[model samples]
Target: MLKSTTPTMVEAGTKTKKKHRTFSLNAKDKYYALLFLGPSLLILSVFVFYPMLRTLYISMFLTNTLGKTTVFNGLGNYTDLLGSPEYIASLGSTLVYVFAVTILTVGIGLLLANLASKRLPGIGVFRTLYSVTMGVSVSVAAIFWLFIFNPSTGFFALLSNMVGLPVINWLTDPTMAMWAVIITTVWMNLGFTFLILLGAISSVPTTLYEAASIEGASERRQFFKITVPMISPTLFFVSTITLIEGFKSFGLIDLITKGGPTNSTNMLVYRIYKDAFYSGNYAQASSEAIILTVIIAFFTFLQFKFLEKRVNY
Candidate 1:
Protein backbone atom coordinates (compact mmCIF):
# COMPACT_ATOMS: atom_id res chain seq x y z
CA MET A 1 0.00 0.00 0.00
CA LEU A 2 3.00 2.26 0.22
CA LYS A 3 3.10 4.18 -3.04
CA SER A 4 3.08 3.78 -6.81
CA THR A 5 6.42 4.98 -8.18
CA THR A 6 6.54 6.14 -11.78
CA PRO A 7 8.74 4.13 -14.14
CA THR A 8 10.17 7.43 -15.46
CA MET A 9 11.76 8.19 -12.07
CA VAL A 10 13.40 4.77 -11.84
CA GLU A 11 14.55 4.95 -15.46
CA ALA A 12 16.01 8.42 -14.97
CA GLY A 13 18.02 7.27 -11.93
CA THR A 14 19.27 4.24 -13.82
CA LYS A 15 20.36 6.36 -16.80
CA THR A 16 22.27 8.79 -14.61
CA LYS A 17 24.23 6.00 -12.90
CA LYS A 18 25.00 4.38 -16.25
CA LYS A 19 26.33 7.66 -17.63
CA HIS A 20 28.55 8.16 -14.62
CA ARG A 21 29.92 4.65 -14.82
CA THR A 22 30.59 4.94 -18.55
CA PHE A 23 32.71 8.01 -18.09
CA SER A 24 34.70 6.64 -15.17
CA LEU A 25 38.01 4.76 -15.61
CA ASN A 26 39.60 3.96 -12.27
CA ALA A 27 40.80 7.53 -11.53
CA LYS A 28 44.24 6.05 -11.03
CA ASP A 29 44.76 5.71 -14.77
CA LYS A 30 43.82 9.32 -15.39
CA TYR A 31 46.03 10.55 -12.58
CA TYR A 32 48.97 8.48 -13.77
CA ALA A 33 48.57 9.73 -17.32
CA LEU A 34 48.55 13.37 -16.25
CA LEU A 35 51.48 12.77 -13.95
CA PHE A 36 53.56 11.33 -16.80
CA LEU A 37 52.51 13.86 -19.44
CA GLY A 38 52.68 17.06 -17.38
CA PRO A 39 56.43 17.06 -16.88
CA SER A 40 57.22 16.38 -20.57
CA LEU A 41 54.83 19.08 -21.83
CA LEU A 42 56.25 21.62 -19.41
CA ILE A 43 59.79 20.93 -20.54
CA LEU A 44 58.92 21.19 -24.22
CA SER A 45 57.08 24.46 -23.77
CA VAL A 46 59.75 26.10 -21.64
CA PHE A 47 62.92 24.90 -23.30
CA VAL A 48 61.89 24.25 -26.90
CA PHE A 49 59.13 26.61 -27.97
CA TYR A 50 60.10 29.76 -26.11
CA PRO A 51 63.66 29.91 -27.37
CA MET A 52 62.58 28.91 -30.88
CA LEU A 53 60.33 31.95 -31.24
CA ARG A 54 62.90 34.36 -29.82
CA THR A 55 65.63 32.99 -32.08
CA LEU A 56 63.48 33.39 -35.17
CA TYR A 57 62.52 36.97 -34.34
CA ILE A 58 66.07 38.02 -33.65
CA SER A 59 67.29 36.81 -37.04
CA MET A 60 65.76 39.56 -39.19
CA PHE A 61 68.12 42.50 -38.78
CA LEU A 62 71.65 43.90 -39.14
CA THR A 63 74.20 44.74 -36.43
CA ASN A 64 77.93 45.36 -36.22
CA THR A 65 80.78 46.84 -34.18
CA LEU A 66 79.39 50.41 -34.36
CA GLY A 67 76.54 49.77 -31.94
CA LYS A 68 73.40 47.80 -31.24
CA THR A 69 71.22 48.36 -34.27
CA THR A 70 68.45 46.66 -36.22
CA VAL A 71 68.52 47.73 -39.86
CA PHE A 72 65.63 45.62 -41.23
CA ASN A 73 67.88 43.59 -43.48
CA GLY A 74 65.13 41.24 -44.63
CA LEU A 75 66.63 37.91 -45.80
CA GLY A 76 70.05 39.48 -46.36
CA ASN A 77 71.47 37.85 -43.25
CA TYR A 78 70.41 34.42 -44.44
CA THR A 79 71.83 34.98 -47.92
CA ASP A 80 75.18 36.17 -46.60
CA LEU A 81 75.47 33.36 -44.09
CA LEU A 82 74.65 30.74 -46.71
CA GLY A 83 77.19 32.21 -49.09
CA SER A 84 80.03 32.46 -46.57
CA PRO A 85 82.71 29.77 -46.50
CA GLU A 86 82.72 29.69 -42.75
CA TYR A 87 79.03 28.92 -42.57
CA ILE A 88 79.28 26.27 -45.28
CA ALA A 89 82.19 24.57 -43.54
CA SER A 90 80.39 24.66 -40.24
CA LEU A 91 77.31 23.13 -41.83
CA GLY A 92 79.39 20.28 -43.20
CA SER A 93 81.03 19.70 -39.86
CA THR A 94 77.66 19.79 -38.15
CA LEU A 95 76.26 17.15 -40.50
CA VAL A 96 79.17 14.84 -39.78
CA TYR A 97 78.71 15.23 -36.07
CA VAL A 98 74.98 14.56 -36.33
CA PHE A 99 75.55 11.33 -38.21
CA ALA A 100 78.32 10.20 -35.91
CA VAL A 101 76.39 10.76 -32.74
CA THR A 102 73.13 9.32 -34.04
CA ILE A 103 74.80 6.15 -35.26
CA LEU A 104 76.75 5.66 -32.08
CA THR A 105 73.86 6.32 -29.72
CA VAL A 106 71.37 4.13 -31.54
CA GLY A 107 73.75 1.28 -32.27
CA ILE A 108 75.17 1.08 -28.79
CA GLY A 109 71.84 1.77 -27.14
CA LEU A 110 70.04 -1.04 -28.89
CA LEU A 111 72.83 -3.48 -28.13
CA LEU A 112 72.85 -2.62 -24.47
CA ALA A 113 69.08 -2.79 -24.32
CA ASN A 114 69.12 -6.28 -25.78
CA LEU A 115 71.64 -7.44 -23.22
CA ALA A 116 69.73 -5.89 -20.36
CA SER A 117 66.42 -7.39 -21.43
CA LYS A 118 67.67 -10.85 -20.42
CA ARG A 119 66.85 -10.19 -16.74
CA LEU A 120 70.31 -10.97 -15.52
CA PRO A 121 71.28 -10.64 -11.85
CA GLY A 122 72.29 -7.14 -10.70
CA ILE A 123 71.05 -5.63 -13.98
CA GLY A 124 69.16 -2.98 -12.06
CA VAL A 125 72.27 -1.78 -10.30
CA PHE A 126 74.25 -1.81 -13.54
CA ARG A 127 71.54 0.21 -15.29
CA THR A 128 71.53 2.86 -12.55
CA LEU A 129 75.30 3.29 -12.59
CA TYR A 130 75.37 3.47 -16.37
CA SER A 131 72.78 6.24 -16.44
CA VAL A 132 74.43 8.31 -13.68
CA THR A 133 76.58 10.13 -16.20
CA MET A 134 73.45 11.53 -17.86
CA GLY A 135 72.76 13.57 -14.73
CA VAL A 136 75.90 15.61 -15.42
CA SER A 137 75.64 18.65 -17.63
CA VAL A 138 77.19 18.57 -21.08
CA SER A 139 79.65 21.33 -20.09
CA VAL A 140 80.75 19.42 -17.03
CA ALA A 141 81.08 16.17 -18.98
CA ALA A 142 83.09 17.97 -21.67
CA ILE A 143 85.51 19.31 -19.09
CA PHE A 144 85.87 15.85 -17.59
CA TRP A 145 86.79 14.42 -20.97
CA LEU A 146 89.19 17.32 -21.45
CA PHE A 147 91.07 16.26 -18.34
CA ILE A 148 90.95 12.60 -19.33
CA PHE A 149 92.44 13.42 -22.72
CA ASN A 150 94.98 15.91 -21.46
CA PRO A 151 98.55 15.09 -22.55
CA SER A 152 100.74 15.91 -19.57
CA THR A 153 98.46 15.50 -16.55
CA GLY A 154 95.73 13.12 -17.61
CA PHE A 155 94.57 9.54 -17.11
CA PHE A 156 95.76 8.73 -20.61
CA ALA A 157 99.25 9.94 -19.85
CA LEU A 158 99.45 7.49 -16.98
CA LEU A 159 97.99 4.69 -19.11
CA SER A 160 100.42 5.55 -21.91
CA ASN A 161 103.32 5.00 -19.54
CA MET A 162 101.86 1.59 -18.64
CA VAL A 163 102.18 0.61 -22.33
CA GLY A 164 105.45 2.55 -22.81
CA LEU A 165 103.82 4.82 -25.44
CA PRO A 166 104.65 8.51 -25.82
CA VAL A 167 102.18 11.06 -24.52
CA ILE A 168 99.62 12.19 -27.14
CA ASN A 169 97.95 15.62 -27.15
CA TRP A 170 94.47 14.34 -27.92
CA LEU A 171 92.56 17.55 -27.24
CA THR A 172 95.04 20.07 -28.67
CA ASP A 173 95.27 18.14 -31.91
CA PRO A 174 92.64 18.92 -34.53
CA THR A 175 92.14 15.32 -35.58
CA MET A 176 91.50 13.69 -32.18
CA ALA A 177 89.40 16.32 -30.40
CA MET A 178 86.17 15.65 -32.28
CA TRP A 179 86.52 11.91 -31.64
CA ALA A 180 86.95 12.61 -27.95
CA VAL A 181 83.76 14.62 -27.95
CA ILE A 182 81.86 11.90 -29.79
CA ILE A 183 83.03 9.21 -27.40
CA THR A 184 82.03 11.28 -24.39
CA THR A 185 78.61 12.04 -25.84
CA VAL A 186 78.01 8.43 -26.70
CA TRP A 187 79.01 7.23 -23.26
CA MET A 188 76.92 9.79 -21.42
CA ASN A 189 73.79 9.41 -23.57
CA LEU A 190 73.70 5.67 -24.17
CA GLY A 191 72.12 4.80 -20.84
CA PHE A 192 68.89 6.71 -21.33
CA THR A 193 68.67 5.66 -24.92
CA PHE A 194 69.21 2.10 -23.82
CA LEU A 195 66.43 2.39 -21.29
CA ILE A 196 64.04 3.57 -24.00
CA LEU A 197 64.91 0.61 -26.20
CA LEU A 198 64.67 -1.79 -23.30
CA GLY A 199 61.15 -0.63 -22.49
CA ALA A 200 60.16 -0.88 -26.12
CA ILE A 201 61.58 -4.37 -26.34
CA SER A 202 59.87 -5.54 -23.18
CA SER A 203 56.52 -4.29 -24.38
CA VAL A 204 56.68 -6.76 -27.21
CA PRO A 205 54.21 -9.44 -26.19
CA THR A 206 55.61 -12.59 -24.63
CA THR A 207 53.39 -14.57 -26.98
CA LEU A 208 55.50 -13.41 -29.89
CA TYR A 209 58.64 -14.78 -28.32
CA GLU A 210 56.93 -18.08 -27.54
CA ALA A 211 55.64 -18.30 -31.08
CA ALA A 212 59.10 -17.62 -32.47
CA SER A 213 60.55 -20.30 -30.25
CA ILE A 214 57.91 -22.78 -31.35
CA GLU A 215 58.84 -22.15 -34.95
CA GLY A 216 62.49 -23.09 -34.33
CA ALA A 217 63.60 -19.45 -34.71
CA SER A 218 67.11 -18.86 -33.38
CA GLU A 219 67.71 -16.05 -30.89
CA ARG A 220 69.37 -13.87 -33.52
CA ARG A 221 66.60 -14.57 -35.97
CA GLN A 222 63.94 -13.79 -33.42
CA PHE A 223 65.67 -10.53 -32.55
CA PHE A 224 66.02 -9.44 -36.17
CA LYS A 225 62.52 -10.42 -37.17
CA ILE A 226 60.43 -9.66 -34.10
CA THR A 227 62.32 -7.43 -31.67
CA VAL A 228 63.72 -5.03 -34.25
CA PRO A 229 60.47 -4.47 -36.11
CA MET A 230 58.58 -3.97 -32.87
CA ILE A 231 61.12 -1.54 -31.45
CA SER A 232 61.94 0.37 -34.65
CA PRO A 233 59.83 3.38 -33.72
CA THR A 234 61.78 3.90 -30.49
CA LEU A 235 65.07 3.57 -32.30
CA PHE A 236 64.07 6.12 -34.90
CA PHE A 237 62.92 8.51 -32.19
CA VAL A 238 66.23 8.33 -30.29
CA SER A 239 68.29 8.72 -33.44
CA THR A 240 66.39 11.82 -34.57
CA ILE A 241 66.77 13.41 -31.14
CA THR A 242 70.49 12.69 -31.04
CA LEU A 243 70.88 14.17 -34.51
CA ILE A 244 69.17 17.43 -33.52
CA GLU A 245 71.25 17.70 -30.36
CA GLY A 246 74.44 17.10 -32.32
CA PHE A 247 73.63 20.05 -34.57
CA LYS A 248 73.02 22.26 -31.54
CA SER A 249 76.27 21.32 -29.80
CA PHE A 250 78.03 24.37 -28.44
CA GLY A 251 78.76 23.95 -24.77
CA LEU A 252 81.22 21.14 -25.35
CA ILE A 253 82.84 22.94 -28.24
CA ASP A 254 83.21 26.10 -26.21
CA LEU A 255 84.10 24.68 -22.80
CA ILE A 256 86.25 21.74 -23.82
CA THR A 257 87.76 22.12 -27.28
CA LYS A 258 87.17 25.83 -28.03
CA GLY A 259 86.55 24.77 -31.64
CA GLY A 260 90.35 24.43 -32.05
CA PRO A 261 93.32 23.67 -32.81
CA THR A 262 91.74 25.38 -35.79
CA ASN A 263 88.10 25.47 -36.95
CA SER A 264 87.85 21.70 -36.97
CA THR A 265 85.29 21.43 -34.21
CA ASN A 266 83.45 24.68 -34.87
CA MET A 267 79.86 23.47 -35.00
CA LEU A 268 77.07 25.69 -36.31
CA VAL A 269 75.62 26.32 -32.86
CA TYR A 270 78.95 27.47 -31.48
CA ARG A 271 79.43 29.78 -34.46
CA ILE A 272 76.03 31.33 -33.84
CA TYR A 273 76.86 31.87 -30.16
CA LYS A 274 80.29 33.38 -30.82
CA ASP A 275 78.89 35.79 -33.38
CA ALA A 276 76.18 37.04 -31.03
CA PHE A 277 78.05 37.26 -27.72
CA TYR A 278 81.71 37.68 -28.65
CA SER A 279 81.45 39.64 -31.91
CA GLY A 280 78.33 41.63 -30.90
CA ASN A 281 76.68 40.78 -34.20
CA TYR A 282 73.38 39.47 -32.97
CA ALA A 283 71.76 39.75 -36.34
CA GLN A 284 74.35 37.59 -38.05
CA ALA A 285 74.21 35.05 -35.27
CA SER A 286 70.44 34.99 -35.45
CA SER A 287 70.64 34.51 -39.17
CA GLU A 288 72.98 31.58 -38.72
CA ALA A 289 70.65 30.19 -36.10
CA ILE A 290 67.76 30.47 -38.51
CA ILE A 291 69.69 28.52 -41.08
CA LEU A 292 70.46 25.85 -38.55
CA THR A 293 66.80 25.79 -37.60
CA VAL A 294 65.77 25.31 -41.17
CA ILE A 295 68.25 22.51 -41.66
CA ILE A 296 67.10 20.81 -38.49
CA ALA A 297 63.48 21.34 -39.46
CA PHE A 298 64.07 19.69 -42.81
CA PHE A 299 65.57 16.65 -41.15
CA THR A 300 62.76 16.58 -38.63
CA PHE A 301 60.21 16.65 -41.42
CA LEU A 302 61.93 13.82 -43.22
CA GLN A 303 61.98 11.79 -40.04
CA PHE A 304 58.25 12.22 -39.52
CA LYS A 305 57.45 11.57 -43.12
CA PHE A 306 59.53 8.43 -43.53
CA LEU A 307 60.61 7.11 -40.16
CA GLU A 308 57.42 7.84 -38.26
CA LYS A 309 55.40 6.01 -40.86
CA ARG A 310 57.26 2.86 -39.92
CA VAL A 311 56.15 2.98 -36.28
CA ASN A 312 54.97 -0.40 -35.07
CA TYR A 313 51.31 -1.11 -34.52
Candidate 2:
Protein backbone atom coordinates (compact mmCIF):
# COMPACT_ATOMS: atom_id res chain seq x y z
CA MET A 1 0.00 0.00 0.00
CA LEU A 2 2.85 2.44 0.90
CA LYS A 3 4.72 1.64 -2.33
CA SER A 4 1.64 2.14 -4.46
CA THR A 5 0.86 5.52 -2.81
CA THR A 6 4.50 6.62 -3.32
CA PRO A 7 4.30 5.81 -7.05
CA THR A 8 1.09 7.86 -7.42
CA MET A 9 2.76 10.89 -5.78
CA VAL A 10 5.77 10.53 -8.11
CA GLU A 11 3.48 10.47 -11.17
CA ALA A 12 1.63 13.58 -9.98
CA GLY A 13 4.94 15.41 -9.48
CA THR A 14 6.08 14.42 -12.95
CA LYS A 15 2.87 15.75 -14.47
CA THR A 16 3.30 19.08 -12.64
CA LYS A 17 6.90 19.30 -13.85
CA LYS A 18 5.80 18.66 -17.43
CA LYS A 19 3.16 21.38 -17.19
CA HIS A 20 5.70 23.89 -15.90
CA ARG A 21 8.14 23.02 -18.66
CA THR A 22 5.41 23.40 -21.23
CA PHE A 23 4.48 26.83 -19.88
CA SER A 24 8.11 27.94 -20.00
CA LEU A 25 8.52 26.67 -23.56
CA ASN A 26 5.36 28.51 -24.63
CA ALA A 27 6.69 31.76 -23.19
CA LYS A 28 10.00 31.31 -25.01
CA ASP A 29 8.17 30.54 -28.25
CA LYS A 30 6.13 33.75 -27.96
CA TYR A 31 9.29 35.78 -27.39
CA TYR A 32 10.97 34.25 -30.44
CA ALA A 33 7.83 34.80 -32.51
CA LEU A 34 7.91 38.50 -31.73
CA LEU A 35 11.61 38.60 -32.41
CA PHE A 36 11.02 37.08 -35.85
CA LEU A 37 8.21 39.54 -36.60
CA GLY A 38 10.28 42.58 -35.57
CA PRO A 39 12.00 43.03 -38.95
CA SER A 40 8.76 42.89 -40.95
CA LEU A 41 7.00 45.24 -38.53
CA LEU A 42 9.89 47.70 -38.73
CA ILE A 43 9.90 47.60 -42.55
CA LEU A 44 6.14 48.13 -42.80
CA SER A 45 6.24 51.06 -40.38
CA VAL A 46 9.07 52.77 -42.15
CA PHE A 47 7.92 52.17 -45.72
CA VAL A 48 4.15 51.76 -45.76
CA PHE A 49 2.69 53.35 -42.65
CA TYR A 50 5.07 56.31 -42.66
CA PRO A 51 4.43 57.18 -46.33
CA MET A 52 0.65 57.00 -45.82
CA LEU A 53 0.81 59.37 -42.85
CA ARG A 54 3.08 61.73 -44.75
CA THR A 55 0.78 61.77 -47.76
CA LEU A 56 -2.13 62.67 -45.48
CA TYR A 57 -0.20 65.50 -43.88
CA ILE A 58 1.02 66.81 -47.20
CA SER A 59 -2.50 66.84 -48.64
CA MET A 60 -3.54 69.56 -46.22
CA PHE A 61 -1.06 72.11 -47.59
CA LEU A 62 -0.25 73.66 -50.94
CA THR A 63 3.20 72.77 -52.22
CA ASN A 64 5.49 73.94 -54.96
CA THR A 65 7.00 71.88 -57.76
CA LEU A 66 9.90 71.01 -55.53
CA GLY A 67 7.39 69.76 -52.94
CA LYS A 68 8.06 72.63 -50.55
CA THR A 69 5.00 73.78 -48.65
CA THR A 70 3.76 77.13 -49.99
CA VAL A 71 0.58 77.73 -48.02
CA PHE A 72 -1.85 76.05 -45.68
CA ASN A 73 -4.73 75.17 -47.99
CA GLY A 74 -6.69 73.06 -45.51
CA LEU A 75 -9.45 71.42 -47.60
CA GLY A 76 -9.08 73.74 -50.57
CA ASN A 77 -7.20 71.15 -52.57
CA TYR A 78 -9.96 68.58 -52.10
CA THR A 79 -12.74 71.03 -53.00
CA ASP A 80 -10.83 72.34 -56.00
CA LEU A 81 -10.24 68.84 -57.26
CA LEU A 82 -13.92 67.96 -56.92
CA GLY A 83 -14.87 70.98 -59.02
CA SER A 84 -12.16 70.60 -61.67
CA PRO A 85 -13.15 69.21 -65.06
CA GLU A 86 -9.88 67.37 -65.45
CA TYR A 87 -10.37 65.65 -62.11
CA ILE A 88 -13.93 64.70 -63.01
CA ALA A 89 -12.76 63.26 -66.31
CA SER A 90 -10.03 61.35 -64.55
CA LEU A 91 -12.61 59.93 -62.16
CA GLY A 92 -14.78 58.76 -65.03
CA SER A 93 -11.88 57.19 -66.85
CA THR A 94 -10.77 55.42 -63.70
CA LEU A 95 -14.24 53.97 -63.16
CA VAL A 96 -14.51 52.66 -66.70
CA TYR A 97 -10.97 51.27 -66.71
CA VAL A 98 -11.39 49.47 -63.39
CA PHE A 99 -14.70 47.91 -64.36
CA ALA A 100 -13.51 46.75 -67.75
CA VAL A 101 -10.26 45.24 -66.50
CA THR A 102 -11.88 43.55 -63.50
CA ILE A 103 -14.65 41.97 -65.53
CA LEU A 104 -12.42 40.85 -68.40
CA THR A 105 -9.69 39.43 -66.21
CA VAL A 106 -11.98 37.37 -63.98
CA GLY A 107 -14.13 36.17 -66.85
CA ILE A 108 -11.21 35.12 -68.99
CA GLY A 109 -9.46 33.56 -66.03
CA LEU A 110 -12.48 31.40 -65.20
CA LEU A 111 -12.82 30.29 -68.78
CA LEU A 112 -9.18 29.40 -69.12
CA ALA A 113 -9.16 27.63 -65.75
CA ASN A 114 -12.07 25.43 -66.76
CA LEU A 115 -10.41 24.48 -69.99
CA ALA A 116 -7.11 23.74 -68.28
CA SER A 117 -8.82 21.55 -65.70
CA LYS A 118 -9.64 18.96 -68.37
CA ARG A 119 -7.71 15.67 -68.36
CA LEU A 120 -6.09 15.67 -71.77
CA PRO A 121 -2.79 14.54 -73.15
CA GLY A 122 -0.15 17.27 -72.91
CA ILE A 123 -2.49 19.33 -70.73
CA GLY A 124 0.28 20.20 -68.26
CA VAL A 125 2.37 21.62 -71.10
CA PHE A 126 -0.55 23.67 -72.33
CA ARG A 127 -1.28 25.01 -68.85
CA THR A 128 2.35 25.97 -68.35
CA LEU A 129 2.56 27.69 -71.71
CA TYR A 130 -0.62 29.62 -71.03
CA SER A 131 0.60 30.79 -67.63
CA VAL A 132 3.89 32.11 -69.03
CA THR A 133 2.52 35.63 -68.98
CA MET A 134 2.69 35.58 -65.19
CA GLY A 135 6.46 35.64 -65.44
CA VAL A 136 6.44 38.85 -67.55
CA SER A 137 6.88 42.04 -65.57
CA VAL A 138 4.33 44.81 -66.05
CA SER A 139 6.88 47.06 -67.77
CA VAL A 140 7.90 44.30 -70.11
CA ALA A 141 4.31 43.38 -70.89
CA ALA A 142 3.56 47.06 -71.53
CA ILE A 143 6.46 47.24 -73.95
CA PHE A 144 5.23 44.16 -75.76
CA TRP A 145 1.79 45.63 -76.13
CA LEU A 146 3.29 48.92 -77.25
CA PHE A 147 5.04 47.15 -80.09
CA ILE A 148 1.81 45.45 -81.07
CA PHE A 149 -0.20 48.64 -80.89
CA ASN A 150 2.33 50.85 -82.69
CA PRO A 151 0.45 52.45 -85.58
CA SER A 152 3.17 52.54 -88.20
CA THR A 153 4.61 49.00 -88.24
CA GLY A 154 2.84 46.87 -85.67
CA PHE A 155 1.28 43.47 -86.39
CA PHE A 156 -2.20 44.92 -85.91
CA ALA A 157 -1.49 47.59 -88.49
CA LEU A 158 -0.32 45.04 -91.05
CA LEU A 159 -3.21 42.69 -90.30
CA SER A 160 -5.82 45.43 -90.27
CA ASN A 161 -4.69 46.75 -93.66
CA MET A 162 -4.47 43.24 -95.08
CA VAL A 163 -7.97 42.26 -93.94
CA GLY A 164 -9.51 45.68 -94.58
CA LEU A 165 -10.30 45.90 -90.87
CA PRO A 166 -10.39 49.74 -90.89
CA VAL A 167 -7.28 50.58 -88.91
CA ILE A 168 -7.35 53.45 -86.37
CA ASN A 169 -4.58 54.84 -84.20
CA TRP A 170 -4.71 52.33 -81.36
CA LEU A 171 -2.69 54.34 -78.84
CA THR A 172 -3.34 57.89 -80.01
CA ASP A 173 -7.06 57.84 -80.82
CA PRO A 174 -9.14 59.13 -77.92
CA THR A 175 -12.10 56.90 -78.71
CA MET A 176 -10.14 53.65 -78.98
CA ALA A 177 -7.18 54.45 -76.67
CA MET A 178 -8.89 53.32 -73.49
CA TRP A 179 -9.98 50.11 -75.15
CA ALA A 180 -6.42 49.42 -76.20
CA VAL A 181 -5.18 49.98 -72.67
CA ILE A 182 -7.89 47.78 -71.28
CA ILE A 183 -6.99 44.98 -73.65
CA THR A 184 -3.34 45.26 -72.62
CA THR A 185 -4.25 45.19 -68.93
CA VAL A 186 -6.45 42.16 -69.37
CA TRP A 187 -3.71 40.25 -71.17
CA MET A 188 -1.05 41.16 -68.64
CA ASN A 189 -3.22 40.07 -65.69
CA LEU A 190 -4.60 36.93 -67.33
CA GLY A 191 -1.84 34.53 -66.28
CA PHE A 192 -2.10 35.30 -62.58
CA THR A 193 -5.88 34.87 -62.62
CA PHE A 194 -5.66 31.63 -64.59
CA LEU A 195 -3.08 30.09 -62.29
CA ILE A 196 -5.01 31.00 -59.14
CA LEU A 197 -8.25 29.58 -60.45
CA LEU A 198 -6.53 26.46 -61.72
CA GLY A 199 -5.06 25.75 -58.31
CA ALA A 200 -8.42 26.28 -56.65
CA ILE A 201 -10.16 24.05 -59.16
CA SER A 202 -7.57 21.31 -58.79
CA SER A 203 -7.75 21.33 -55.00
CA VAL A 204 -11.41 20.44 -55.17
CA PRO A 205 -11.98 16.77 -54.24
CA THR A 206 -12.90 14.40 -57.02
CA THR A 207 -15.23 12.61 -54.66
CA LEU A 208 -17.67 15.47 -54.82
CA TYR A 209 -17.88 15.26 -58.60
CA GLU A 210 -18.32 11.52 -58.40
CA ALA A 211 -21.11 11.91 -55.88
CA ALA A 212 -22.78 14.49 -58.07
CA SER A 213 -22.47 12.30 -61.13
CA ILE A 214 -24.12 9.46 -59.25
CA GLU A 215 -27.05 11.78 -58.65
CA GLY A 216 -27.33 12.38 -62.45
CA ALA A 217 -26.00 15.97 -62.26
CA SER A 218 -24.82 17.40 -65.57
CA GLU A 219 -21.33 18.73 -66.03
CA ARG A 220 -22.60 22.29 -66.05
CA ARG A 221 -24.60 21.69 -62.91
CA GLN A 222 -21.61 20.12 -61.17
CA PHE A 223 -19.45 23.11 -62.05
CA PHE A 224 -21.92 25.70 -60.96
CA LYS A 225 -23.26 23.91 -57.90
CA ILE A 226 -20.21 22.06 -56.63
CA THR A 227 -16.99 23.41 -58.10
CA VAL A 228 -17.91 27.03 -57.59
CA PRO A 229 -18.86 26.71 -53.95
CA MET A 230 -15.69 24.83 -53.15
CA ILE A 231 -13.58 27.53 -54.77
CA SER A 232 -15.55 30.63 -53.83
CA PRO A 233 -12.83 31.73 -51.42
CA THR A 234 -10.23 31.80 -54.18
CA LEU A 235 -12.64 33.69 -56.42
CA PHE A 236 -13.20 36.29 -53.76
CA PHE A 237 -9.46 36.68 -53.17
CA VAL A 238 -8.78 37.02 -56.90
CA SER A 239 -11.51 39.63 -57.33
CA THR A 240 -10.26 41.74 -54.45
CA ILE A 241 -6.63 41.71 -55.57
CA THR A 242 -7.60 42.38 -59.19
CA LEU A 243 -9.74 45.33 -58.15
CA ILE A 244 -6.80 46.85 -56.26
CA GLU A 245 -4.50 46.13 -59.16
CA GLY A 246 -6.90 47.85 -61.56
CA PHE A 247 -6.97 50.97 -59.40
CA LYS A 248 -3.21 51.07 -58.98
CA SER A 249 -2.39 50.36 -62.61
CA PHE A 250 -0.01 53.06 -63.78
CA GLY A 251 2.79 51.25 -65.55
CA LEU A 252 0.69 49.99 -68.45
CA ILE A 253 -1.15 53.26 -68.89
CA ASP A 254 2.04 55.25 -68.63
CA LEU A 255 3.78 53.13 -71.22
CA ILE A 256 0.97 52.55 -73.71
CA THR A 257 -1.32 55.58 -73.50
CA LYS A 258 0.27 58.09 -71.09
CA GLY A 259 -3.30 59.26 -70.49
CA GLY A 260 -3.30 60.30 -74.10
CA PRO A 261 -5.82 61.75 -76.58
CA THR A 262 -7.45 64.08 -74.04
CA ASN A 263 -6.52 62.03 -71.01
CA SER A 264 -8.79 59.16 -71.91
CA THR A 265 -6.75 56.71 -69.87
CA ASN A 266 -5.99 58.98 -66.96
CA MET A 267 -6.50 56.72 -63.95
CA LEU A 268 -6.29 58.10 -60.44
CA VAL A 269 -2.87 56.64 -59.79
CA TYR A 270 -1.55 58.06 -63.01
CA ARG A 271 -3.24 61.35 -62.20
CA ILE A 272 -1.29 61.48 -58.96
CA TYR A 273 1.92 60.91 -60.89
CA LYS A 274 1.02 63.58 -63.44
CA ASP A 275 0.34 66.14 -60.72
CA ALA A 276 3.40 65.36 -58.62
CA PHE A 277 6.07 64.71 -61.21
CA TYR A 278 4.85 66.59 -64.27
CA SER A 279 2.90 69.52 -62.89
CA GLY A 280 4.98 69.84 -59.70
CA ASN A 281 1.91 70.06 -57.48
CA TYR A 282 2.80 67.53 -54.84
CA ALA A 283 0.05 68.60 -52.43
CA GLN A 284 -2.70 68.05 -54.95
CA ALA A 285 -1.13 64.73 -55.92
CA SER A 286 -1.09 63.74 -52.28
CA SER A 287 -4.76 64.59 -51.99
CA GLU A 288 -5.60 62.42 -54.98
CA ALA A 289 -3.46 59.65 -53.56
CA ILE A 290 -5.40 59.73 -50.32
CA ILE A 291 -8.67 59.67 -52.19
CA LEU A 292 -7.57 56.71 -54.28
CA THR A 293 -6.57 54.85 -51.15
CA VAL A 294 -9.97 55.56 -49.62
CA ILE A 295 -11.76 54.36 -52.75
CA ILE A 296 -9.81 51.11 -52.88
CA ALA A 297 -10.38 50.58 -49.16
CA PHE A 298 -14.13 51.12 -49.53
CA PHE A 299 -14.44 48.55 -52.30
CA THR A 300 -12.28 46.04 -50.49
CA PHE A 301 -14.37 46.43 -47.36
CA LEU A 302 -17.53 45.93 -49.38
CA GLN A 303 -16.14 42.74 -50.91
CA PHE A 304 -15.25 41.34 -47.51
CA LYS A 305 -18.61 42.29 -46.03
CA PHE A 306 -20.90 41.00 -48.74
CA LEU A 307 -18.86 38.42 -50.66
CA GLU A 308 -17.20 36.65 -47.76
CA LYS A 309 -20.59 35.40 -46.64
CA ARG A 310 -20.90 33.36 -49.83
CA VAL A 311 -17.48 31.79 -49.45
CA ASN A 312 -17.91 28.20 -48.27
CA TYR A 313 -14.92 28.33 -45.96
Error of 1 at 177 (Å): 1.2
Estimate every model's Cα lDDT from 0 to 1.
Answer: 0.81, 0.89
Query: In terms of TM-score, which candidate is strongest?
Result: 2
Candidate 1 lDDT over 171-223, as tens digits, reads 87777877877788787788778878889998989899999999999999999
Worst 10 residues of 2 by lDDT: 17-26
lDDT per residue for candidate 2 within 129-193, as digits (tens), equals 76889999988988888888888788899899999887779988887899999999899889999
What would the TM-scores of all predictions be?
0.78, 0.86
Off by over 4 Å in 1: 1-60, 70-72
RMSD of each: 10.4, 8.8
Candidate 2 has what TM-score? 0.86
